[model samples]
Target: MATCAAPSESDAPGHPDRSRDDRWAASGAQLRALVDAFRSEPVTPARTLQFEHDVQIVVRELGRQVVPFRYNQVEPAAAVDQPRHARFEHETYTRVHAKTRQNVWTVFGQLVVRRIGDRPSQAGEPMLFPRAHRLGLVHGASPALAARACQLLAAAGANQQQILARLRADHGVGWGVKKWRPVSRAVSDEMGVYRHDAQVDQLRTWLAAAGASTGRHKPVVCVGRDGITLRLRMKRGSLYEVASTSTVRVYDRRGTRLGTVYLAYAPEPGRPAMRGALTAVIRDVLTRWEGPVPRWCDVTDTGDNETGYDDRVLRRMTHPRTGAALAWVRVVDYYHASERVWALANMLFGDNARAVGWAKTMLTWLLLPGGVNRVLHSAAAFRAARTLTRVQKKEYDRAYAYLRNRMSHIDYATYRRVGVPLGSGGTEAACKTVFIQRLKLRGMRWAKDGAQTILNLRVVFLSGIWDVVYGRVLAARPQPIMGGHVAAEPNELEIAA
Candidate 1:
């Protein structure tokens, strides 16, 4: 067996390269011992866990050993264009430390990166490490670890405290909010670059699948949207704001939903961002469909926000190739329609059993052919029989108007027969699951940026496109210059050290 008699660096807070070779040898020894011990011992739960822990320790050490070799490959000597003495370059920078030490958090453990770094002469400028950027080491964590952190933080009901605890216990990574928050946010920002393209690709794939699906009816694409209330941090003038979410799904001719893609945005006065994005996504998929035009529809509740978006965006959309207006079938959520019925019933019967029976009959009537008109007629009969107080009369009129205004869109009977979804249940659930489920936990109030980061990640994740989107985003950024990190977002600047 290969032996490790070299001194250990375990006592030091940061591992130095002088003893990294020794640690690499020790890690190999540890791995061999671990396997041998596990094989010699009888299988047991405790023994298995011990083996796993031991493996993690040795593997982490091995990962740390990789940092130097990876940077060594980037050293200028191998380059035909640059002189061997020129280390890592950023713009015109050639003066760099032979070995610049950096501490980075990894899934395995904290790995210290000894890389070639350039020091900009400008005052107040941070040191730049080209190798770190190539390896996607930014915001104090490597890409692998950052992806894990983002996923855990974006998970429903996930908080920094819970994620930190998990990281400490399982991955041996001890990161506090100071480190974790920035890393998670940085990854979320990175995702913004490729998330839309990934979503569009996935949507096209689903639409193609639907077009090819064989059944009695043509394939259908249904779009739904809704909103939920969010609690903002105290600094914001209004402590509460409305957040919106949209879901687009492909339905086979059999009326089975094939797949769904979700998009969301933080609270905006009119949700213009979300609406524009939703419009583009739908248009892209529709234009890409090589088969017959699918039955496209907007299925949502009749909230002003929801209907206004439909009227302004969906109704006005046109085919990219031909410029012909794209018409969308309208559908008022059946559940929301039913709720309005109960509102009127309660106003008439004052929560009596008669109201319950009457609401049930009206909903049942709503499923038949020409049901909306029938329900309106039945409502008129009830109003004629009762002597309502002014308050009851006023509230009843409001409830009645809710149904009346959406009467044209509430064609539940034809929609059901043709396999069109009459309910916006998916979008309603997204309002809760995408936004409220994660951000509305007790004592949680968010700054717009923090909440938006989570929503951006959550939308892609819940849409079943996490790997596709995240993998591209986390992959190394295109080689911009010889060294240094990718340029920061427009407003934010980063001087990588």
Candidate 2:
């Protein structure tokens, strides 16, 4: 098989780098021969096999020729400890034995990177190929390949095996699931770091802008918060229910969703941590708003878990650095409230013809002017008129408590007039899109870290900030450097495959 070779220092006089040109020309010639052979074969199963084989050969040769050119461009020149005509005496690089590292697979073919450096005991020891670090090239795959693998995983929602198949079929890159998994994890981990840094920068910029504002009137901002349960595999072989929160932001009109953010905890975060995560989401929204700080509205369901969300979470949010309170009016989701009313109606009327009729009338009153007052009056009258059974009384009491507890949040008429949203549908949909669609796939079980990392990528992609976030991620990665002593090679890097 054809293999890539680095450019040698020795060259014949007056020859115009014939070695490099000849390698390129030879690869080209072989590619042409493969094409010819493929075309000459008849349309049989054997012929199809021959064509595939020929294509692989051509790609291998092309990769062999191209890798060297790229490597040489960024490879450091031979080290010069001292020279007679040197301008400075600070030069310290010295030539040493070059060792062959593991081969990395790419779309083209297997790529061999030779590590050039000093002896183990030398001062500047174990010099590496600078281009490799610049490109984030790993022992098993190049950065480009790793990134491509991650993109596929994110976009296709494919498992490791499926991703490997798609890559080989679509891009001509071949690697097993074991190789792809770590690359995916590494890229996702980098993404997590990028997300944190981006949020910090955003907060700083928002603080600066807030400080400069002249306190002009701004439009109201509507935020919807909700949680979705994710099934996670426990280390002890049972399933665990983890709650992930989703937040959605919309402008004054609530017609177009501005953005959505998700906080997914695999092993389940504590209440304080969950609250902090939620606070971060609100902060992100404030940072992205163009106008001055606006009135805030939070629409959420009235489930037991979400009952105190307003007081416990939203009310507690403040500017991390400035300590300014972020106050928002809490609104119970209209649909959730309506569902309770429907249940009350069913309990009161049973299979009577008036059940649906009463439910519709109650729903209309709940949404009309003086709705909560009218609904409360009607409930009181109904309770006084009926000598209910114990079960019936219990249901009625429960329904009354639900409405009374959220009475402040049930003012649909005022909310409608003010253009505030009354539903948490945006948050619910966001939960489905950001987490359920990808992470909750069939037979999928994730480690805590792995799930969180993947969630980071999914959020960035769904929020339409993948490109920006990914660029930042690449920038945030520490540039690989040569170490003083001989670095211990990873098991995968020990052999060229």
Candidate 3:
């Protein structure tokens, strides 16, 4: 007993160093225990309840234990009372740790201030600087936009202010307001609901429109050598004249100029409006003509409303087969025929002479078999042909109900071999691009003068409006009042946070 046999390896002092064999055996035993715990049957509800009750009984029985150790040079009474003092010291420690916590760690910061209700309750205490409230009114972006901006800012090594400024300049402040906020870890929890609702509404409107517009209509092909007809309204205050015009240029299969028909009114004494009306009609008809044809009509009416001018002038040109139609080659049907042809040539090609040569070549090609019809329609057959679909027939006979003629003289199969646009959409698309892109915007309300200037400049710019737009805007300060309200002013205060 006095010698105590040198301690066995298992009873060695608690040193960190361990033998390989002992470590291996210990790890194997631990793994076995872990596997057994995982595979064991689950505790039943009654067993769980009983176990919880056992834990409660054990904790209650342990209670609080205190020991006295006033070994310092103190009075006898103080030494005896040390255990009572120790109990009070622990009570204060427990109160501070469990019940009397002053600062609660939160999103904004360790919460330094909180206002409880009069009765010391949760009521009336606003969650100060809630993520939702702060993300909207105070910030320049919705939470998601702000978060994206924050990410970009971080990558760019820029501050929140700089990112916000860039966003404002690019998209406008009003557009992105609600996204300004300090960078937050939990941004996903702060997204605005309104943005998603707006997107859903837009999809609904699109689906409704798609569902409603589903009827098939025959395409109207106007047989005209010049002009695609378009409708317009001319208005001065209360009185507005709804009208159409034909001041359009027609192009052939190769995008070559056919003619320019200026819709002009019949001249009359003291009837300016009526004259303008007929000219407007001519313009409209020309604008709407769908394809190339020989029988394009230009409207003309006598000034006096007392009698309507005979529509025969228009009808004769519209019905080329009626013998009254004037051949374009005839000099009598033209104005400054040589000059007009020369200009047309210039439009078709850079060199007028080359264009003329090309035109002659096209004329020879038009007489081939593909250009001529294989079957001749009798009067009866002509009448029956009128019942055919409008889109199927290239031309409809104005004189006879069924005697339809083809619109384009060129063979479409051959034309396809060459690059040719089926519709003259190039010029129309260009016009819309020039007009709508420059002038139209959401919620745009235009006044006469402002619209006219912008439109003129837009067309000018589109037609090559750059020089005029720059020169005019530079000539004077762009008017404060444009389209409607004053043009928005640049913000003086810096936007970057």
The global C-alpha lDDT for each of the candidates, from Candidate 1 onward, is 0.75, 0.62, 0.29
Tens digits of lDDT, candidate 2, 1-497: 22333322211233335655776788778878877876776678977876787677666556655664445334332333211121112223443544444465665655555544433333654543433455566545676677677777776357667877777764566677667767777778777666644543443343344344443223445556566666666768746565566554544333333444445445464545556665666676565544456567888886555656666767777865456887677888888888878777777777577878887888999989888778778767866877878998898888878898778889998877766777888777877776677777778877767777677677656655566677886665544323333222233122211
State the local distance difference test value for candidate 1: 0.75
Quote the positional error of residue 197 for candidate 2 in Å: 5.0
Q: After superposition, how far is residue 460 of candidate 3 from its true place, in Å?
A: 2.1
Off by over 4 Å in 2: 1-68, 77-96, 107-109, 117-131, 197-220, 252-254, 269-273, 284-290, 303-309, 318-325, 351-353, 383-388, 480-497
Question: Each model's TM-score, in the order given?
Answer: 0.85, 0.74, 0.22
lDDT of 3: 0.29
Clashing residue pairs for model 1: none
Over 209-280, each residue of candidate 1 has an lDDT whose tens digit, in order, gives 877777887788889988888988875454888888899888988888888888888889889888888888
Q: For every candidate structure, what is the RMSD over all alpha carbons to the true structure, in angstroms?
A: 6.5, 7.8, 29.5
In model 2, the number of clashes is: 0
